[model samples]
Target: MTTSRSFVLICTVGIFCFISYNMVRMPALSLFAESLGAGPERIGLIVSVSTLTGVLLKLPSGALSDIYGRRFLLRIGVVAFGLPPFLYPFITSLDALTALRFLHGLATAIFAPSALATVAELYRERRGAALGTYTACTQSGSLLGPFLGGYLIHAAGFSTAFVTAGVFGCVAMVLFYSLHLDVSVPQRKEQGTAAVLSEMWKGFSVVAKNTKVLITSVTDAAKMIANGALMAFLPLYGVSAGLNPGEVGLLFTVQACTSFFSKPIMGRVSDRMGRQPLILLGLSICAGTFVCIPHVSMFPVLLLLSAGFGFGEAVVSSSSSALVADSSEFKTLGAGMGMQGTIMDIGHASGPLLAGLLIASLSYPMAFGVIAGVQLLAAGVFWVTMKRM
Candidate 1:
C-alpha cells in the first residue's frame, strides 16, 4: 500500500479501536464496578489492572513484532480489541470484570507498539507529524467514546453501552484487516532459536543503552501518571462534586478535543524545532494543570483545566514517540516503541494504584499534588540529564 493509504487506514483503525477501549474504560468501568459493589481501592485495581497487562506484555510484543512482523501481531491485537467488549455485558462480579479488563488490555499491549512501529517505518522522515496524526485519530475516538458511553449508560444502560462499544471494536478490526497491507518478509536467512534470542537481545540492548529513548520514555511516563490518575478518578470526583455522568464524559471529551487539535501542530513544530524543548514544555503544562484539578469545582473551570492538560498531553506525546523512533536503530524501532510503552504503562498502572492509596488516606488535593510533584521531578531530571549529555 502507498504510505498515504496506509496512514489513513491505520488512523481509521486507531479511531475505532480506541473508541471501543475508552467506551468501556472511562465512566463505564468505574461506574460499572461501583454498581458491582466495588469500593475506591477495588475500582482502582480494576482500572489499573488493564494497564498492568500492558506493562508486562508491551515490550515482548513489540520485540516480537520486530523479529516476526507487524501485520501478524496487529491482526492478533485487533482481534483482542474487537471481541472482549462483547463479553462485558455478561460479567457477573468485580473479579470477573477485572479479568476481562486485563484481557482487553492485551489488545493495546499488542496493537500499540506494532502500529507505532509501522508508522515509524512508513514515515521515517516525517515521523513526528505522522505519529501525531495517528494519535490524534485515537484521541478523537477517546473524545467521542466516553461521551457516548456515558450517555448510553444514562439512557439505555451498561449492557447497551458495552454492546455498542463491541460493535465499534469489531468495525475497527474489520477495517484494519481489510486495509493494512501484509508486512514484507525480511531477506535475512532463517536462524536457530539461539540466534533469534541473540538478535532480540541486541535489539533490547540497543534500546536500553539509548539515553534519549530512556529519558523520553520516562518523561512520557510522568505525563501518563497524571493522565491515568485523571482518567481513573475524574469521573468519580466529578460525580461526587455533583456533575452527572454525561457531564463527566464531556470533561474527557473536552480534554481529548484539545489534544486532537494540538498534537499535529505541535508535532510539526517538533519536526522543525526539535523534540526536547516541546517535551519539557508539555510536561510542565500537565504538572500545573493536574495539580489544579482538585481545586476547581465549577464545570467550566474544570473543562478549561482539562483542555490545558490535553494540550500538554498532546505536545509531549506527539514528540515522545517520534523521539523514541528517532533514537533507535532502523531494525529496532518496534523495540524502542515497546520500551516506551512498557515504561509509560508502568506510570499509567501506578497512577490509579497510588491515587487510590493517597485518596484513601489524604485529601484529593494532597493526592493530586504528589502526582504533580512526580511529573515536575521527572522534568527536572530530564532537563539536567539532557544538558549534561
Candidate 2:
C-alpha cells in the first residue's frame, strides 16, 4: 500500500481500536469495580493493573517488533484489544476484573509502539505533524468512547456498553486485517533463538542509554500520572459532585475533544517553534488546571478544567513522542518508543495508586494538589537536565 494509504488505514484502525478500549476503560471500569464491592484502594488497583501490563511488556514488545516486524505485533495487539471486552460482562469479582484488565493492557502495550514506529518510519521528515495527527486520531477515540460508553451505561447498562465496545474493537480488527502494510522488517543473518535475544537486548541497551529519550519519556510520564489519576477517580468524584454517569462521561469527552483538536495544531507548532518550550508550557498548563479540579463542584467549571487539562495533554503528547523519535537510532526506533511507553506506563500506573492513597488518607483536593505538584517538579528536573546535556 502507498504511504498515505497506510497512514490513513493505521489512523482509522487506531480510532476504532481505542474507541473499544476506552469504552471499557474510563467511567465504566471504575464504576464497574465499585459495583463489584471494591473500595477506593481496590478500585485503584483494578484500574492500574492494566497499565502494569504495559510497564512489564511494552519494551520487549517494541524491541521484538523492531526485529520481527510491526505488522506481526500489530496483529496480536488488535486481538488483545478486540477480545478482552467480551469478558468484562463475566467478571463477578475484583480479582477477575483485575486479571482481565491486565490481559486487555496487552493490546496497547503491543500496538502503540509498533504503530508509532511505523508512523515515524513513514514520515521521517515531518514526524511531529505525522505523530500528532496519528495520536489525534486515537484521541478522537478517547473523545467519543467515554461519551458513548457513558450514554450506553446510563441508557442500557454495563453489559450493553461492554458488548458495544467489543463490536468497535472487532471492526478495528477487521479493518486492520484487510489493510496491507508495506513496511520493511529488519534483515538478520542469524535465525537462532539466542541471536534474536541478543538482537532484542542490543535494541534495549541502546535505547535505555539514550539520555534525550529517557528525559523526554520521564517528562511525558509526569503528565500521564495526572491523566491516570483522573481516569480512575473522576467518575466517582463526578457522581459525588451530583453529576450522572452521562455527565461524568461528558467531562472525559470534553477533555478529549480539546486534546483531539489541539494535538495536530500544537504538533505543527512544535515542529516550527521547537519542542522543549511547548513541553514546559504544557506541563504548566496541566499543573495549573489539575490542582484546581477538586476545589470546584460545578459542572460547567469542571468541564472547563477538564478541557484545560486535555489541551495540556495534547501539547505534551504531540511533542514528546516526536522528540523520542528524533532522539532514537533508526534501527532501534521501536525500542525507543517502547522505552517511552514503559516509563510512561510506570507513571500512569502510579497515578491511581498514589491518588487512592492520598484521597483515602487525606482528601481529593490534597490528593490532586500533590499529584499536580509532581508534574511541576518533573518539569523543573527536565529543564535542568536538558540544559546540562
Candidate 3:
C-alpha cells in the first residue's frame, strides 16, 4: 500500500479501537461495577485492573514485536479490543467484570507500542507530527466515548452499551485487517526460544539504558497520575459541586476536544522547535490547572481548567512519544515504546488508588494539591536530567 493509504488505515484503526475501549471505560464501567454491588474500593480496583494488564504485558509484547513483527502483535491486539465487550453482558459479578477488564487490557498492552513503532518507522523525518496525529485520532475516540456511553447507558441499558461498543470494535478490526504495509522492520531470525529471549533481553537493555527515554517516560507518568485521578473522581466532584450528570460529562468532552485539536499542532511545533521546551511548559500547565481544579465550582471556570489540562496533556504527549523514538536505537523502537507504556500504566494505576486514599483521608483540595506537587517535582527532575542531554 502507498504510505498515505497505510497511514490513513492505521489512524482509522486507532480511532475505532479507542472508541470501543473507552466506551466501556469511563462512566459505564464504574456504573456497571456499582450495579454489581461494588464499593468505592472495589470499583477503583476494577477500573485500574485494565492498566495492570498493560503494565505486565507492554514491555514483552513490544520486545517481541521488535524481534518478530509489528503486524502479528497488532492483529492480536486488535482481536483483544474487538472481542472482549461481547462478554461483558455475561458478567454476573464484580469479579467477573474485573477479570474481563484485565483481559481487555491486553489489547492496549500489545497494540500501543506496536502501533507507535510503526508510525515512527513510517515517518522518521516527520515523526512528531505523525505520532501526534495518530494519538489525536485516538483522542477523538476519547472525546466521544464517555458522552456516547453515558447517553446509551441512560437511554437503553448496560447490555446495549456493551453491544454497541462491540460493534465499533469489530469495525476497527476489519479496518486493521485491510491494511497492507511494507513499512515493518525486518525481523530477527532467532533459531530457538533461548535465542528469542536473548534478543528480547537485548532490546530491553537498550531501552533501559537510555537516559532520555527513561526521564521523559517518568515525567509522562507524573502527568498521567493527575489524569487518572481526574478520570476517577471528577464526575463525583462535579456532581457534589451541583453539576448534573450531563455537565459532568461535558467536562470530559471539553478536555478531550482540546486535546484532539491541540496534539497535532503541538506535535508539529515539537518537530520544529524541539521537544524539551514543550514538555516543560506542558507539565507546568498541567500542574497549575490540576491544582486549580478543586478551587473552582463554577462550570465555566472548571471547563477552562479542564481545557487547560487537556492542552497541556496534548503538548506533553505529542512530544514524549517522539522523544522516546528519538532516544531509542532504530531496531528497539518497539521495546522503548513498550517501556514507556509500562511505566505510564504504573502511574495511571497508581493515580486512582492514591487519590482514593487521599480523598478518603483528607479533602479534595488537599488531594489535588499533593498530586499537582508531584507533577511539579517531575518537571524539575525532567528539566535537570534533560539539561545534560
Off by over 4 Å in 2: none
> Which sections of candidate 3 miss by over 4 Å?
none
lDDT of each: 0.91, 0.95, 0.88
Worst 10 residues of 2 by lDDT: 179-188
lDDT of candidate 3 vs native? 0.88
Quote the positional error of residue 102 for candidate 3 in Å.
Answer: 0.9
Model 2 steric clash pairs: none
Kindly give the stretch of ten consecutive residues in candidate 1 with the minimal lDDT sum. Answer: 180-189
Q: Write the per-residue lDDT of candidate 3 for residues 1-389, one digit (tens) a residue.
A: 88877888888998999888888886678778877997656766888889999999999999999888888888899888899989999999888898999999999999999999988888999999999999999898878877777778777888888888899999999888876755665655657899989999999998999999899999999999998888778867887898755577678878889999999999999999999999999999999999999989999999999999999999999999999999999888999999999999998988887887888788899999999999999999999988877
| TM-score versus the correct structure, for each prediction | 0.98, 0.99, 0.96
What clash count goes with each model? Answer: 0, 0, 0
lDDT pick, better of 1 and 3:
1
Lowest summed-lDDT stretch of 10 residues in model 3? 181-190
TM-score of 3: 0.96
lDDT of 1 at 377: 98
